[model samples]
Target: MKIAFYGSSLVSSYWNGAATYYRGILHALARRGYDITFYEPDAFDRQQHRDIDAPDWCRSVVYPATEEGLRGVLAEAGGADIVVKANGVGVFDRELLEGVVARARPGALRLFWDVDAAATLDEMRADALHPVLAALPDLEMVLTYGGGPPVVGAYEGFGAAACVPVYNALDPATHHPVPADDRFACDLAFLGNRLPDREARVEEFFLRPAASLSDRRFLIGGNGWETKAMPANVRHRGHVYTAEHNAFNASPLAVLNVARDSMAHVGFSPATRVFEAAGAAACLITDAWEGIEQFLKPDDEVLVARDGQDVADHLAALTPERAKAIGEAALRRVLAEHTYELRGAQVDALFKAAMAERRVAA
Candidate 1:
């Protein structure tokens, strides 16, 4: 039951959007009598950005996280029953990854939990460090937060013993619907950090709608959005953290999701915002992607928009009551099947299977 959950600074929720997802799943596992030791590189004080810290559910070990420091820390993981090395740990290089593999105790589970599967696989395919994934047979498991079926296929194709898609799910305790506030609410708002790929999509899908409905209000939030010569009606609020995110969503009529380059291209990567928006009972309008309908019912729980005209149409067509109904339905779906607790249970099941196989081998 002793698990070494090694990854980024879950201590901070500021820039690290994955914090709640980690916390929800790990905390749920802890309640099941699993003893978790969360190892994080003591980087920026994530506590400064968020209102909380590692809950009493697990023990957190903050290491100095230099190359040498990681060597020392990886050595500490030897005693645990499972050691999970998630991508985007924010303190990784070949040395840390290789050292963990070399130093990992045989019989103890090792997981390359790729939170960003689409991007990570791309990195593995292109880089000299590609052997990192090919060495999966030596590890116990491979888990992904998104990429659903495509992720599982790729890992097994590469000769992995096991690959599981542990897609992102809701952490209902922290993400529930908030009361819609008129002052903060808008007919449609898009909240995402500005990225080159997303910027183009935003212009095509979000900005155009805002411009089309000049009489209506539109709000944009997230970091790296300064370059956009946004319309005056499109208010840009830079980098709203977890605390502010719910209010931001509550203030909007429907929140738009523009996937980043890696995710949009991959077709299965839904951002944390998807669940958050749904959980908050805020209507969601997302760009068309092949795999989206699997998670949400288009024109029902979610509105699929491929262009600015589509977005404008959704805005003009839907009433508040209907939008509320969609948000509620999406929330029900998330709560039923998409929570982080469920994702963690999925991880535990894989561990159980791996351990069972090990026993059979013995």
Candidate 2:
């Protein structure tokens, strides 16, 4: 099978949260004998500041951020077995979705994969006439990162023929335990691009905790955070690149996962950081979110916190042996059931089932 995916930069995680998802899933699909081509706009300086070299498994195209560029890519995607327009593509997504669904081969599966389903659904609900809702009936299927049952039901309610939640998972080859590095060593570490939806949660879950734990070291990674005033005990390091993830994860005594307000409310949504931290065998701490227990057993495989006090308490109570045991358990859980290979196979099965049903309907 040949697949065409349009998304945020596949080569750079710079300000692109979906980069890991794209890279891991596409690489896995390619390994499963599916030919893959990725199309990303050259906007956001992502191409110039790429963090990873081009993968050998797929063709990566950096196109002009214009209408002509969109048309050209859509044309190239004509005969693909699957054509995907993912959310957060950093372009006019409604326009891209329309073009791809309209131009893709009749037998091809035209999918709108929403890596940020919560935000997308919120927009759709805010306006009944949103372009995505208008276009939903035409697409073959819809997929999401972590929206779970609520997200899938919302998309289906919006007139989608089929909607599925394809959660994020770890790539053992890219994100596994590694030797710790001194630079990232800290009592707690948090990594995420600063965005409005997540800023408040970061303040509540990360910054506040740092303030309370003045004796402990807190390291913050990702862009747009350097300007913010933080506790004296906290260190803000701008834009930790993908290549440095293992070291960053290993360096921290315990890693933190703070979900954006949208994702937190939706529940069952685990961000890439959650799996990345687990893959590194870092004692994991996350703010409370529903459906978290389904992924990792709370208080056993992972620690859950509802506020700054909860986080501070977890940090204060953690001992070396207990932390190590928790990290090991989380790593085992992810490696066994939450790897990219498993996710890729699930997506392939969904595509096959959707296509087969389409055939029978025809």
Candidate 3:
């Protein structure tokens, strides 16, 4: 099967949080005999900040961020077995969505892959005329990186023929434990690009704890926090490259996963960082959110925090031995139940079933 994936930069994680998810899932699909061509627009300086060169597993096309470039890619995608217009491509998104639905070869599956389903759903709910809502009826299926049952129900309500939540998972090959790096050493570390929807939560969950725990070192690695004021103990390392993520996750005594306001409210959405930290066998602390127990056992495989005080409390009691124990348990659980290989098999089955249903209908 051939897949034409139009998304934000697959070669860069600069301002694109979905890079890891894209790489993991697409790589797994490639191993399962799907030929993938990832089309990413040359926008947001992501081309200059690329974390990885194009991989042999998939052909990556960096198209100009222009109407002409989009038309070229849409024409090229006509032959694919599956045409995917992922959310937040950063340019010509609506055109790409409508293009794949209208121009994909007859019988080619048209998919809308939403890496940020919670935010997308919020937008759809606010505006009935959202372009995605208009495109849903024509799309074969809606695939989401997170946002479990709520997202599926919302999409179905919006007239999507089918909606499936393909949660983020560990790619052991890319994100397993590595020897800790001194550069990222910290008591608690968080790596997320500063964004409006997430900034307040980061302040509440990460910064507040840093202020309260004056003795414990904290590290923040992401773009846009360089100018933000932070406590003397907190170090802001702007834009840690994906190549160094394993070290970043491993060097920290505990890594924190703070969902965006929308994701937390939506309940079941887990950020890519959660799996990345667990994949590196790092003790993970996540802000309280519904459905986490379905992924990691709280206080055993992971620590759940209700607020900044909860985060501080966890650190206050954390011991090297206990952290190691929790991390190991997380690793075991993810390796057995939440790996990209397993996710790939699930995706393959979904694709097969959907194709069969389409054939029957035809």
Candidate 4:
């Protein structure tokens, strides 16, 4: 199958959090004999901050952030067996959503892949005329990276033919345990780009705990936190590149996964960092969200925290032995059952089944 994926940068994680998810799933699909051409706009300086060269698994096309550039990609999309317009392309999103569906060759499956389904659903609920809501019926299926059953129900309620949640999973080859690096060593470290919906939660789940445990070392790695106020005990490492992520996870005594407000409220949404940290065998401390046990067992493989105090308590009582034990357990579980190869197979099957259903209907 030929897949044309329109998304944020495939070569850069600079300001795009979805980069790893795209890489893992698409690479898995490629391994299963799918030919994928990733179309990403040359915007937000992501091109300059390329994390990996055009991957061998997929052909990458970086188009200008212009109307003409978008039209060119849409023209090429017509040749794909599956045309996917992912959320948050950072440019021409509305046009891309409508265009992929309209320009996709007859009988080609049109999929809208949402990396942030909770936020997208909120937008659709707030505005009846939201582009995605308008585009739902035209799409063959809505695939999400998170927001399991709730997201599926919401999309179906909005008239989508089908909605499948393809949760984030480890790409073991890319994210497995590595030797700890001094640069990322800390008691607790968090890696997330600061954004409006997530900043408050970051303050609660990360900064507050850093202040409460002033004696403990804390590190924050991601873009847009350079100017954010932090406790004296906290260190800010601006924009840790993808190459350093494994070391960043391994070096930290414990890594944190803080979901955005919408995700937490909607529940069942585990950010990509959860799997990445687990893949590196880092003891993960995640904010309370429903359906976490579906991914990692709490109090055994993972530690669940409801607030800053819970985080502080966890850190206060955690010994090096216990942290290591928990991390190892989580790693074992993800490697056994939560790998991208498994996710890729699920996706491949879904595509085949959807195609078969379409054929029968025709």
Consecutive 10-residue window with the lowest summed lDDT within model 1? 44-53
Instruction: For candidate 1, write residues 1-362 as lDDT tens digits.
Output: 78887777666665566776777778878877789988777665554565466668789887786877787778877888887777777666455566556766878777777777777778777874574565676777788777867777877877777777776677887888777666567778777767665778888898888888889888887767777798888877776777666777776778888887677877877888898888888899998876997788887899998789999998999888988899989998888878777777776677788889988888
Candidate 3's residue-wise lDDT over 1-362, tens digit each?
A: 89999999899999999999999989999999999999999999999999999999999999999999988999987889999999999889889988988888989899999999988988999998899999988888999988888889988998998999999999999999999899999999999999999999999999999999999999999999988989999999999999999999999899999999989998888788999999999999999999998899998999999999999999999999999999999999999999999889999998889889879989
Write the number of the candidate with greater TM-score, choosing between 2 and 3.
3
Clashing pairs in 2: none
- Each candidate: what lDDT? 0.78, 0.90, 0.93, 0.94
Model 2 per-residue lDDT tens digits across residues 1-362: 89999888899999898888888888888988999999998898888779888899999988899999988888887879999989888787778888887888888888899999999999999998887888787798888898888998889888888888888999989898999999999999999999999999999889998998889999999999988999999999898898899889887889999999999999999999999989989899999999997789999999999998899999999998999999999999999999999999998899889889879988
Ranking by TM-score, best first? 4, 3, 2, 1
User: What is the C-alpha lDDT profile of model 4 across 1-362, one tens digit per residue?
Assistant: 89999999899999999999999999999999999999999999999998999999999999999999999999998899999999999889999999998999999999999998999998899998999998988999999988988899999999999999998989999998999999998999999999999999999999999999999999999999989989999999999898999999999899999999999998888888999999999999999999999999999999999999999999999998999999999999999999889999999999999999999999
Q: How many backbone clashes does candidate 3 have?
A: 0
State every prediction's TM-score relative to the real structure: 0.92, 0.98, 0.99, 0.99
Q: Is 1 or 2 the stronger prediction by TM-score?
A: 2
Q: Which of 1 and 4 is the better model by TM-score?
A: 4
| Candidate no. 4 TM-score | 0.99
Ranking by lDDT: 4, 3, 2, 1
